[model samples]
Target chain A: MTSAASSPIEFYFDFSSPYGYLAARIIDAEAAELGRKVTWRPFLLGAVMKQTKAEPLLTIPIKGDYARHDLARAARYYDIPFVVPPQFPFASIAACRAFYWLNGTDPAKARDFALFLYERAFLAGKDISKPDSVLEAASDAGLDAAAMALALQDPAIKELLKAEVDKAIKKGVFGSPFFLVDGEPFWGHDRIAEVREWLRKGGW
Target chain B: MTSAASSPIEFYFDFSSPYGYLAARIIDAEAAELGRKVTWRPFLLGAVMKQTKAEPLLTIPIKGDYARHDLARAARYYDIPFVVPPQFPFASIAACRAFYWLNGTDPAKARDFALFLYERAFLAGKDISKPDSVLEAASDAGLDAAAMALALQDPAIKELLKAEVDKAIKKGVFGSPFFLVDGEPFWGHDRIAEVREWLRKGGW
Candidate 1:
């Protein structure tokens, strides 16, 4: 194993995840404040859930109902604006491909693009499940939409995300908004406080 | 609907749940600070999971490993010493019965009994899954040992716990450390901060 200090804090998330969007809004700033850097990796949670036979949050019996209400309360707790999309938990493959494509050259812009897509789907109640819709939003946000559209269909980009998901699963990330400071895993948006403690105290 | 202010916070937990025990360690003091009362209800989460076809935390694939590390980290985060007993996730029926019996007479003493039993199993790493062990813990904690043994076998006490499980399921309580403020549901120990906000702001 390599020295843990060299490993940057990695954030694995899905675009369609409301809590993931909530975490994206603040995690970058939190890391900066803690004098650390974070790498954003968008992975397919549905793919991982499928292997585990796990149901989506909205489909769980009572937990689903609580999550729906908790999302709003948690959003308020973080002082962030959030509105569920018309088609929630939509296929985020297109968004993931776009992020990976942009991330190839401009990682910061990819992050900005990721935030914009999250805002479009969550903040403005837009559906980003389809390629055309994703492209439209990216274009409006002043991104290279044509390249993103091409990247969405690229088989290489498809494999890239597949590999990332495989690696994330290997790292034992089964939930969204999951953070890894070195090899230490922290799951959920709620663990951000605990994440801060880990950063300050350097693991407990 | 009843007056929201009049309805006290309810905490539903199982003695076998580590997260439940962790939350139990603090929910009381937090409620006191908010000038509110909390009721502790111990029900069988196993019963709830049976109907839902949900796997236990340690049984899930990647989530299981993450939960293992998260438990120790969470325990440290809460500043509570927790040790998973020899047989983790053992039946909490005896503990539930003991709690219900004590709750019928002295509610405060019932809470004390609950904490003592939690500490016994989690801190001392003792198995309280059996009636004998639970009775021993209660007796050692200055509770009525002889009477509690009889109560543990009482047909009425058995029915009481069954009814509590059924009623908890009806209230959409499916997880350990599940909290309800007035009629609003908050699941998980992580949501305690949100619970405090809920109590202070009165449904925001």
Candidate 2:
């Protein structure tokens, strides 16, 4: 774990993971405390699952049940307000594409976009799978909503998002929020501490 | 999932997962109640992680913290004894290989062996990783202890164990205890209800 406060930390995420939402709630705050910059990478979870040929989180019986309960418990533990959205697993494709756009143009704006979507879906209980919700989110981030809307339809951006999903698959990521501080992959939201420690030690 | 009582239901397992132990306790009884047979497959969770690139239960933050409390709650819910074994995940290579021996020879005996190991290690506080303890377990199951001890050393049996682990990786299995009937995978011990329902429907 590196103690260098200015180090960069990458967070690969999707809206499908409740723990991702939980992690997002405090990750920015935690990183700020450690004086680290977080790089948000929005990737399609469904595409990643397909490439990895892994079952969705909902398929894991014991873990799935515990996830719902634990998510509520975690929100309380962290003193954050939470609500389960009706259309969960809101189509993450658009959000992922927006992230793809941000990856090239304005990366920090991408981080804000991720947090906006997370808070909307997990805390504010908004349906984020729709394009309009994403547009509203883009507007909230001070980005041109209409321009971002048009960019979402671009096949190249879709392929770009798909390529990142493919990259994550090659790296052996089956789920999110998958975190890699240096070279080591710390999977799931619960692994942030280890990731923080790794960063604290300069990812040795 | 199939309701054909004569046909066995697949039992997917990993040695490191304590919930697998808890599920092993009642799966056979539940299957018997439904007049179905169980086919036990011993798979390596670590190998699955290597294949799918998912983290272990302990490595995942939220899942890890909740697992301790959840396991205790599950024990109470099932009215079963649970001791959280001293060296958890007391390497199941020996136990898994032994299952290979008993699987073909006597599947019922294999089920008994799994239960004994789970009860001893997780409930009675026994170190099942030891050779002597395994021999005792074999003897308790009415198997010849000396012959079983010798059989445990067979390279062919070790290969069989390896094959099961390899097969699990291909099957998109990430954890235990996964239950598959036909092509559908019902992961975790708590998933038995869905497995039972699917069995009632004849197949999934």
Candidate 3:
């Protein structure tokens, strides 16, 4: 296992996950406090679910109701603006492809673009599933809209995202807002406190 | 919705769940702080999972590994002892039936019996899935062994437990360690903080 002090925390998430958005909001700051760098990894949750045969959270029986309430309550807990987009559980293929395209060139700028897209879809209540909206969010985040539009359709860029999703599945990341701190995996945004403690104590 | 002050905090759980054991360790104390009562309702997780088509946490791919780690980590966080039994995802129908039998006669004693059974299974690393083990745990909890032995086979006692499981499903409980505070559902041991906050602020 890599030492916590030397390794960058790997944060795997999907654009369409509310919990993923919540984790994206605070993970950088949380890692910064421990003098750790976080690598923002955007993958497709739908692909992971397909492999796991897991149903969408909103489609499950009792869990669906609790998840809906918890998603909004979690937003309130974090004091972040949130509204469920009308077209939720919508396809995030375009948003994810755009992220990988930008991340390949400028990782920091890609992270900014990710936050921008998350805000548009979750906070501002926009349908980021649309390529046009994704391009708009990309442009707002200071990426060239024309370049992003082209990259979104690039077969190579699409393959990169697919490869990342495959890698994530191999790493046993079956859910969004998953974090790997020096090979230790933590799932869910609620586990941030435990993650912090893990980083602090290395391992218990 | 029932008032938080008057309504008992309903803790729904399956005896075989490690998370349920962890929650059982602290829920009463947490509720006591708010001058609230806790109704320890032990239901079969297998029943809920059947209705939701939800696989046991330990049966899922990546989630299973994380759950094993989290169960132990959560125990350490709460300063409680935990040991995963060799036969995990073990049947808890016997334990549940035993609980209802005792709960029908003495609710307080039933809670004690539940805890005793949990300690035997989780902390002591014993198999309480067997009727003999359930009866032994009940005897250890200061209950009459003969009565419990007879009650364990009673059709009326068996039906009572089944009825509780049905009621839990109808009430939208799809997981162990589920909490209902004034009719608001909170799932997982991780949500205990939210449960406490909800009790304190009476819902936000």
Error at A7, model 2, angstroms = 41
- Model 3 has a DockQ score of 0.58
Task: Choose the strongest candidate by TM-score.
Answer: 3
Give the proportion of true interface contacts each model preserves, from 0 to 1: 0.60, 0.00, 0.50
Candidate 2 lDDT tens digits, A1-204: 655355566677777577788887778777787776777776777775554444566445444554575566557657788887887656788888887887688787777778888888888888788878889988876889998888899999988988887776665565678765554566666566656665665643
Instruction: List the candidate 3 regions with Cα displacement exceeding 4 Å.
Output: A1-3, A140-142, B1-3
Q: TM-score of each candidate? A: 0.90, 0.54, 0.92
Clashing pairs in 1: none
Docking class of 3: medium
Model 2, B73-183: lDDT tens per residue?
Answer: 568768888887677656678878887888868887787778777777888787777667888977876778887788789988888888888787666566788876665
- Judge candidate 1 at residue A126 and give its lDDT: 92
Best of the two (1, 2) by lDDT: 1
If ranked by TM-score, best first, what sequence of candidates would result? Answer: 3, 1, 2
**TM-score, model 2 to reference:** 0.54
Can you rank all candidates by DockQ, best first? 1, 3, 2
Give the winner by TM-score: 2 or 3: 3
Model 1 lDDT tens row, B13-109: 9898989999989998988888778899999999998866688887788898888888888898778998988898798999999999998899899
Query: Per-model TM-score of chain A alone?
Result: 0.95, 0.86, 0.95
